[model samples]
Target: MASSMLAPAVGDIAKEFRASDKAALAGQTSFVCMLGIGPLFLAPMSETFGRRKVFVVNSAMFTLLQIPTALSPNIASFIAFRALSGFFGSVGVANGGGSIFDMFDVHERAPVLGFYLTAPLVAPSIGPLLGSVIVRSLDWRWIFWCMCMLAAFVTTFIYFFLYETNPVAILQARKSELQKKHPDVEYEVEGASDESIPKKIMNASDLTCSPENGTRAVKILTTQPIVLILSSYQALIFASMYSLFATYTDIWSQPPYNFTTIQTGLAFLGPVVGFVTMSTLVILYIDSIYNYVARKNDDDGLPEYRLVFANIGAVLLPISLFMFGWTVEMGLAWPVPLVATVLFGASQVSIFNPVQTYYIDAYAKHAASALAAGAFLRSMIGGVVPLFVGQMCVFPSTSTRRF
Candidate 1:
């Protein structure tokens, strides 16, 4: 939400700070770039220390960082703080799939996973909508202030309510407890350090950040073909989605349309509607498909069974893109192009939910790392694509359609 919430206010911010176009855009790009990068390290760290600890600590940091961002004196400072916030704020993205994997079996996972995945997919569209209202009525910095308040609430909820779900972390804690209770008996946890009780207490790092465990995510990401292919496909979808988001204001606010900031933000509802509608369908039917297919295959489910909806998404994506591009180029009624975004949004959820579920099924134990690998690539491309979108908008229709 914080990543692209300022889209409607970029021009306002540029005017106030006398910043270049690129610098203003960096307000969005810098945050997104770190969102990709942070998961690479944080996801693996979750495997070691535990998901709850990583989530609580990083979420608090992400919330606190928003203060400096809201009060930033210059574009450079704003971008720097926003980037830091993104890094810390990515805990959910880093470990959510792993958490889901810990709790659910394959047949039960699809609906839950589909619902979980909607937060990231739908939040971006909603961010701009709320941001436009805030930007219209309040100062641009208020956007970050709002984010800080929301983050604080979410962080508090997490600390109080969320429990440790990682099986490895749970076993390690149990082993530590058993060792303290029965000094004569050997209590060992696989993947945990064999440090003395005092040493483990004195130096949590040895227990929590083992070198081998820390590097596991990197190894899986680098060595696994399934992870690599799925991550690449996810990256492409993210990049394309963010590219459209980056150019949305430019497309609707100019020339024939002449939309207000609020109206421009409301335009994002097209995608929001699509996301909600398809997410409903996915939540209802995805698990059913998986179970039926598994039954046909002697109750054994391959990760590839998750790809059923992805085919539908792939087909919808190109048609929607072309429809959106040509309709806007022709300067048709706003609804025509908005319908394209609806299809785009539906396609996005259809692909994202299935692919993410496949990642968890394929690497159940290492799901966090697998997701992090995919998120790292997805966010990197999503971040970079936006920087070029402004330039791309300058080209003629013949060239722009290629986007």
Candidate 2:
């Protein structure tokens, strides 16, 4: 949601600070880059500590960071704080798949994960829509304030209702209780003791950020064919999606459309509608498809079966991209481009959900790290792609339409 807010306000930000389109757009790019990077440090902590503990602490930090962002006096401060916000915000993005693996079996994940993963994909679209409204009705700073309010609401809910779902963390807590109750018996459960804060930080950092685990993340990237292909595919899709989100204002707020800020924000509803509609379909049918495919294979479900929707997405995404590009470039009706956005959103969810489910199924034990690697690449692409979008606007021939 924080990621989406600045898209609608970039122009306003440009005007307020007398910055170029490229400079204004950096706010989005920088935040996304940190989104990829911060998780490298934070996610391993979840494995060391507990998912709920990490989530609560980081979510609180994320919520607090928004205050500095909203109160930023200049663009430099805003960008810096925005990056910090994204860094803290990535805890959920990095560790969410791991939480899903902790909670559900493979068969149960199909429908449940489809529903779960939908928020990350949908939030970017919804963010811009809400940003448009907020930017139109209020000052740009309110966007961050609004995000802070939402984050606080979510954090409170998580603190009270969320339990430690990680088995290792749960067992450690149990061991502590049992030991205190029966001091006569020396209970020494291997890998089940609580560590001090400083110790946890050092150990987790050494384990995940040290040369060995650092190399392991890289090794997974280089050696695992599915990781490479799927991560790159997701990266390109996310990059393309972000390019549109970052630039739609340029398209809509001018000549033929002359849209108001609210209208420009509302324009994102097309993609949101498409996303919701298709994800609902996935929630309804993904399990049935998985079950049917498993039965056909003698009741054994292969990760490969998840690719059925991905194949459909591969076909649909390109078609939508082409339609959106040509319609906007050829000066077709505005609605044509919006409908294309819907298709693009639909295809995005289709590909993202299944590919991610496949990854979790394939690497259940290390799903957090595997997903972190994928998100690192995906966010790197998202971060870099928008930097060039402003340049493309200068030379229409070099724009997304060319692709």
Best by TM-score: 2
Task: Candidate 2: count the clashes.
Answer: 0
Model 2 lDDT per residue over 1-403, tens place: 7787789888788788788767878888888988887767666777778799989998999999989988877788888988888888999887898898999998788788888888888888889888888887898889989999999999999999989878888888888799899988776656554568787677666644353233345456668998998989999999998998888888887655678888888898888887898899888888788778889889688887877788778988999999987788766668999999999999998999888888888887567777777888899898889888766764143233332
Model 2 scores a TM of 0.93
Q: Between which residue pairs do clashes occur in model 1?
A: none
Tens-digit per-residue lDDT, 1-403, candidate 1 = 8888998888888988899877888988888988888887787777767889999999999999999998988988988998899999888898899899989987788899989999898999999999999988999999999999999999999999999998878998898799899999997787776657455434432323343544455566678887778778878888888888888888887755768888899999998888999999999998778878889989677998988988888899899999998888877778999999999999999998998898889887878878887888788888888787777676344334333
After best superposition, candidate 1 residue 370: deviation in angstroms? Answer: 0.2
lDDT of 2: 0.82
Candidate 1 stretches greater than 4 Å from native: 195-211, 395-403
Could you tell me the lDDT of residue 99 within candidate 1? 91
C-alpha RMSD of candidate 2 = 3.0
Candidate 2: segments with Cα more than 4 A from true spot: 190-197, 207-218, 394-403
